[model samples]
Target: MEQLSNNYGEFAHFPEKVIQFGEGNFMRGFVDWQLQQMNKQGLFNGSAVVVQPISQGLGKMLKEQDYLYTVILEGLLDGKTVNTSEIISTVNRVLNPYEEWQEYLALAEDENLEIILSNTTEAGIAYDESDALNDTPPKSFPAKLTALLYKRYQLQKPGFTIIPCELIDRNGEKLLAIIQQYAEHWDLKADFKTWLTKENTFCCSLVDRIVPGYPRDRADELNEKHGYIDNLMVKAEPFMLWVIEGPQKIKEILPLQEAGLNVIVTDDMTPYRERKVHLLNGPHTAMVPLARLAGLETVEEVMLDADFSVFVDDLFARELIPMLDLPEAELAAYAEQIKERFKNPFVRHELSSIALNSVSKFQARLLPILLRFYDTKNSLPLGITAALAALIVSYLQEAGNDDAEVLALFAEAKELPTTEQVAFLLAQTKLWGQDLTEVAPLVDTVNDLVQKIHEVGTRAVIKEIHQQAE
Candidate 1:
């Protein structure tokens, strides 16, 4: 079969108006896919110039395919199985900043480059004090971005609509603050700092999609089906959402919504963020330890299990939905959507992968709801407490993946008596941001659940608690 490239068929080449960082599957499947739709519909006549954020990345592989690839979206939509594929031609080229540092910085001179998109992961947006402005591509993502923005400032080019898709809270604001710190550290003029503040529009965005990149298992079959070899083929679910918090004028800039895409350009995205974190991520975090203990490998497996599915449904409908401030009907609808997404057989979301840094995940995703549930109902949320117990037990068994300190703490806790171990884990102010033991009856309840889980196993405990709830 021929390699997937522009040589295979005629394709429109648009101006490189988007400078995107991170050329991973998520970007190609979500952002680039959306851009291709926009371009095809004549809403946006532009393509993205992808910058590989790290020294080693998919730059060479992407360039080999002429920056062209396919996105296969497969999942349940409205109770129907939908599988679709499209060749994405929205990527103009790939540039590795590590090798082409000068060329990377030169993109700042393009007046047509009005937007900047990034998904460098949560840790990608950090301030490295060691990074120097003169260094090739700098050391950190923020530093690289700072250097590029400085070049744009020098050229007096119109500032970009900088939208960061990093899964951090206030991502755009955090990124902008780091760039400001770099400006201060590098002794750039006050005027440049002012330009960074006034000229640039940083938007905090929330992106939701499950892009499992490069289907290695069925690569040969997919290649034959498409009549070409696509090294960068990404598999994702049919669902996609990009909620960008920016000024009203940004709608005129990107016009993503105008293209009939599932993009929401909002003035405030706090509610949307809450919806995703609590309804979607909260259950995901809560279920990982329990599901893994129940001998489940993937999310679909967990959803297929009779007991686990009911447990998940109860956790969402009974515990999580009531804690949210959104409309009850809307939250209920979203909960159903999340359940369907979890049941998607095409996406093999592993429990072990979600288990990483679960302590922090619980603290961020479920802890708030746990606290609110207790406050509102004056009783422990059984499912969340059960989940907490499972988390503690997972750590004790060394089944958790977390920071060295967290692991060490749990390792030490494992040597203590059961009650003391539970109490000790709960009292760690660093883990849950406060001594969770101090909450009335929380420690005793979690201890009971933890003991029950150990005696009966996760599935039995889940079944018992689910029956009690029903």
Candidate 2:
């Protein structure tokens, strides 16, 4: 029933060493939480100065709460359910550049600033030719950063380790490209560009966590239990991963690994990125339609249903795991964690939500796993083939805009028997991006699964296939 504040005597101020670009739910729940962990352990003796990238943001809210909030971590850790709470106090101050441009520029002059962390959404790392250096904090994320870095260059201060947590692939490189373009367009000195390139280290990082943000439904209950009013309280699952693509120098500068956090500082982030797509996204893509057709609403429901759960788990362990390059134990551990996440009671991940734009999602996530599984063993994976057939059935039942071309191909095969329809769908380059019929027995396998699904329904097909796998 006490108000959350630094005046409560539990929080302390450390030297400002980080400029975080967004005060959104994801950053607060993830990056800021990690920083709080490091500070608590005494491994990283620094605080983040929060920067609101846009004109309208959470600056006032953070300022009111003294940049203090609680992170409620709820999910399964190992095999046990966990619900824990911690007050985060690592954000020293929050500044909105639109309102306080001078203060924002002054941060670049702070010699102690070592890390520039940002998550201004996926569109944040874009190039805008119209953003002038003096246009009241600029328009785009990269432009604002360009102006800040130029100011830092003017002070002749050491460059910061810039790690962007944007969802874009090669985010750091793309950011660097935009900055370089800004320098060229602004006609800045050659030495300044060199300093931008040689002095600063831009790192591409992959951040994985589900921050649902501000548990509004349970706010009053949590407030009464904590005996305090936390307006900015954030909710997240227990799992978190931050993979930074960097060499030894970046590791030494941040040294977050010393805190024993789930931060991977490596030379290549490709494998980790692939592992995420294959193991997490791929399973979701492969299962969403099948689960939906079986009248399953949430992921929790699918996991609780005995027949569906076994099929989903077997799909991950037996089929998908063999396609990934990570160590067997590590992949298995992550797979188990993923299962726990899906079964999280606090999270209600609807199958229909996962089914959005599913054609591209399949192409990006499931298609690669299917192709790789075939290339590795010279045979089609049963689970993958079954899921593909289920998807075709679901789309036929209810089509989407992008599904039009594929639906037309399906219509062309309507006259043919179910057996020939499989081969026809396989050869449609517009659908699979390649003629999947080229792979041995894939057509026949998919054809048989299609007919079986039509005969027995989605749930019955799952039960039958799972029984066969057993």
Candidate 3:
């Protein structure tokens, strides 16, 4: 099979206008894929120069293919399963800063450059006090970015719009803070700091997509079908959302909305973030233990069970939706989209994969909704309380076998009744950040669910509750 490149198809080489900080799978599947859409719609007429953020990455492999690869999108769209493939030609080249420091810095001098995008992971935007500006490609992502920005500052060129897609909150602001910290640490000029602060536009962004890249299981089949060998082929769900908090002027510069993509440029991303976390992430965390207890391994399998499906629907509509401040219609629409994504047959999302560190996951994703529901309605949400019970039971059932903390939590409570067990767990302020016992009847509600699950099962309990929901 031939390699994937411009030679295989009619590909236009646009001026490099995007300097991207990561060449990983998410960037390829999400950002680059959208870039391809924008280019096709003539909304964006520019290519990206992908810079490998870490010391080792797919830069060489990407360069080998001339920065061209296929993005295979397979998932549920509307009411049908859709499978589509497109060759993303938006990436012009790939550079490893570790090996090509001068070339990476030279990107700052590009007259066509207008945006600096990155997805260097959650830990990528941290301040490393030891990172020196003179290091051959500084040890940290922020340091390297600082060096690049300083180079651009020296040129007296207009500031590029810096947007980071890291999972951290306010990623753009955090990255800029680290860069500024580097400036102060290295004793860079105040004028350069002024340029960094006054000239640059740092926009925080929220990106959502599930990109399960390099389908190794079907690589050979995919290659044979396409009659081409693509080592960089990426796979993702049909759902993609990019919510950017930026200046109003950004709407004029990056007109991605013209492509009909789910891109929202807003002054505040808080509501969107809260909506996503509660509607999508909260349910994901809630489903993990309950689904696992019900003998379901994958999200699709859980959805297949009529009882579990209805339980999920009720969890969203009756429990989660009422707590959020967003409009009911919009929330319902988004919730439906989330359910469809979960039902994507091509994506085998294991319940256990989402079960990792579930204690903290619940606190971060679901607890806010739980507390808010209590505060507003003066009562606990039954579905979420049951989920809390399921989580507690699931952890205890496999206690001492996984995390040491979980093991310790169960060291002395193994022989107690479910209610007593619930009491002990709820009293651990370190876990919930407060004694959940103070929430009035929440502890009892979880205890009842736990006891009922032990007596009957998750399926039966869910079926009963789902019927009530109807």
Candidate 4:
């Protein structure tokens, strides 16, 4: 096959209009993909400038490819396998802040740059008092953003509309509040806070898209299949959602609404937020252990398996769905859409990736439902308990897939030797922030399940759970 030009040919020209941070799969596949469509329709003729937030990243390689990459979208689109790829050209350039802080800050002054997008992870929004205003690039993401905003403030009265793509609640507002705290800590002028409150806008946003990214292993085969070579081909599911908590201005900026997508610009993001985390993410956390133990590796596999898929469906529509406050029919429809989304044909939402921050995820997504189930039945959810035990065990040893994200999250899990030890640990109230172990039959059951899982294997333990749940 003939090697194509580095720019991905004529498919690389979306006007340079967006300033982005953290060049990762989620941003490229979701945000840039949306912008790509907008550009094609002449609704948003905007290009993106991605900054490498951390020291090491693909920003250099992204620059090498002339900020042009492929977004291979695959998923169930109205009950059909929709697998397709388009070269995304919105990223006009990428900058490494560690190497070129001045250049990065300079680009922040761009008049055309109306949007600021970031996904530096959940812990990215943090306050570090040690991080000084004069630091080349402040230690925390919020600090770095404060510094950049200050530099921009020197020129104009802060016009850049900020949208933090981080998973934290009201991330944009949280980030803005942190920036203000930094300003006060440094004894910056009051006008800065006033400017933040009035002149600038920071909109809370919920971004949902599973971007598996960089099919390095499948590159050669995919390259041959496409009859073209692309070094930065990003793979992801077709199901995506971007809910921005803002007013009419957002519609004027993001032309996604015009494209007839699930992009919602609203004043209240609670419903959308709950729907995503509870309906979609909640089931994912609940299913991991059962699915993994049932000998299923990927989410799609679990959804496809007769027994396991039924397990997931029942958990979503029957157990978990009733816990949500939305209309029953609407919630059921959302639940179905979520299941189909999980069965993405292009990218696999690996059992491993969903396992990242599992404990935290349970607390946010399923803990409420567990509490509700306990209060109503006076009996605990054995399925949820089994999943929890699996998570705790996954942290204990490097026994599963070679997933780096899971390996990194191992430290965050509860520390215990046996299931009994795990029970004792949960009783502390310091870890889960509640004395869940003290509840009737909960702690002993957790310990017992943990022990059984360790003694046998994931499959045998899960089979028992299925029998008990039946």
Best by lDDT: 1
TM per model? 0.85, 0.72, 0.76, 0.87
Regions of candidate 4 where Cα sits further than 4 Å from its true position: 1-8, 12-15, 293-295, 371-379, 399-443
Error of 1 at 257 (Å): 1.6
Candidate 2, residues 1-470, lDDT tens digits: the string is: 67788775667679989999999988999998888888887778889998888888987888888889999999876667879989898889998888889998998888999799999865567677889987887888899899999999999999989999976568899999999999999898899999998999999988888676887778999999888899999988888889999877765667678877788989999989877867877788788878888788877898899888898889888888888888999999889878878888986556765675566567667788888887888867788788888887776666643444456776777768755777877788777668888887877777777788778877888777777878
Best by the TM-score measure = 4
Could you tell me the TM-score of candidate 3? Answer: 0.76
Summarize candidate 3's per-residue lDDT along 408-468 as a digit string, tens digits: 7776567776458889888887567688888888877888889888989888888777776
What are the per-residue Cα lDDT tens digits for candidate 4 across 303-334?
78876776676677556777677899999888
lDDT of each model, Cα atoms only? 0.88, 0.82, 0.84, 0.76
**How much does candidate 1 score in TM-score?**
0.85
Worst-scoring 10-residue span by lDDT in model 2: 398-407
Backbone steric clashes in candidate 4, count: 3
Q: Would you list the clashing residue pairs of candidate 4?
A: 15-47, 17-47, 419-447
What lDDT would candidate 2 get against the real structure? 0.82
For model 1, the superposed segments whose C-alpha errors exceed 4 Å read 78-81, 128-138, 352-363, 378-382, 385-456, 467-470
The lDDT of model 3 is 0.84
